[model samples]
Target: MLNRNNLKVWLKSVSLVGALWVANSALAESPEEKGLRIATERKAADKGWGDSIATTKMILRNAHGEESVREMRLKALEVNGDGDKGLTIFDRPRDVAGTAFLNHSHINEPDDQWLYLPALKRVKRIASRNKSGPFMGSEFSYEDLASFEVAKYTYKYLRDEVVNGEKCWVLESIPTDRYSGYTKQIVWIDQSHYRPQKVEFYDRKRSLLKTLTMSDYKLYLDKYWRAHTLSMVNHQTGKSTDLLTTETQFRVGLEERDFEQNALRRAR
Candidate 1:
């Protein structure tokens, strides 16, 4: 009988074999089909997390190495048959305190998002056309905050490459949204667990705009893997952002109403 750690290793081996089999069996599939299949598998591996809450820290850095930090509370809800809902409530930095952001993602159509400004005491709707703009002076854009929905992009398999010691499948994902600021994105998804290790965003001119790397992954429920930190670097502006999260609490009784627009203003 295998012990806890051995059991984990065995399970991972089985998952790896399954992925290999899937990939090998799809030799006759087109690049688009293969890319979509891999993406579907990636999403399936993270299903049924239900809900979660996390304490987060956002560190923003300018080209001159100047830094500022903002602390926030993040809550997320898993919506069946569609995209997820999320809310972020800022708690620190006197200037940005009491600010909140809400997101409702969808498989098809533009996502709905709103930001609440405590000083103005008003909730501002995020325009779809402006989704590419930076979020709160951070390297991450509003579009980056939206939950991943396979339908949002058209996929094509690029090639295999090793990134950070992990063999990954390189995929080309072109946004379907006409208003999207990006022309396409290149994603490196690890062969193991199908987790994304890195992604490169391309601007409308197909120029590399930024790169995001996810690391410090921790397994939850012995099944799901969540990244503890994300680093986004803007190549053109020499700006960067680091998002760090405390241990996430999964299946935290979060409801849809908890992510409503009104809730943004009420966020503490």
Candidate 2:
């Protein structure tokens, strides 16, 4: 017969083994669930931004290395729903003053984009198919201007690596949109903060086409994290664009009324 002390020791060992098994199982999640978790994390990072205003400077460099700079003051208002909507006004340059960019996104449909150029004094709908094209002669595509929602793509954990001196999780993302210019994307996200540090985009030919670097991240509203500088480099064209967000203010009490089509004309 087994002694009482031996029986107690055996039970304790089994309990420890069961606890470890539960922990290991929790670490292993389904692919879809992992993708959703990543999206949820990204959404949480920007949760407090009901509205915002900012000044932006866009610098464009051509393949021949020619540089052009544009400065603009922006008033942006955002609303949350099944999707999201944002309206931004551009106030700069003698000719493009009072220009406006309106964006409306739906989980089911391609994002609807409209640009009102003061010189034309008319609103032009930006075609959804043209999202892959350059934006105003800049390296950034029209799609880049849209806010990144996690639902836009599916993600897979590729590996773990070090980026910018921090441990990071390397993930591969495939855009669900059939018209997306990129065939696939590789992103490096900081492990601790879950912030995207870098992304490499592949063209339809499955070639490395462009790279995006995000830096100068700051915490807004003590909860939201924002990248102050974003740079896009086009490998094929040898062109690039630097987007510097000089100012950003959140929760400014902006309303949906500020995002209407009619409001675009009167935005400035």
The parts of candidate 1 lying over 4 Å away from their true place are 1-25
TM-scores of all predicted structures? 0.86, 0.85
The segments of candidate 2 whose C-alpha lies over 4 angstroms from its true place after superposition are: 1-24, 30-32
**Span of ten consecutive residues with least summed lDDT in model 1:** 127-136
Clash count of each predicted structure: 0, 0
- What is the per-residue lDDT of model 2 for residues 71-112, given as tens digits with 9 covering 90 to 100? 776665554554567776655555666778887766557877
Query: All candidates' lDDT scores?
Result: 0.89, 0.79
- TM-score: model 2 vs. ground truth: 0.85
Global local distance difference test of model 2:
0.79
Q: How many backbone clashes does candidate 1 have?
A: 0
- Per-residue lDDT for 214 in model 2? 88
Give the candidate number with the greatest lDDT.
Answer: 1
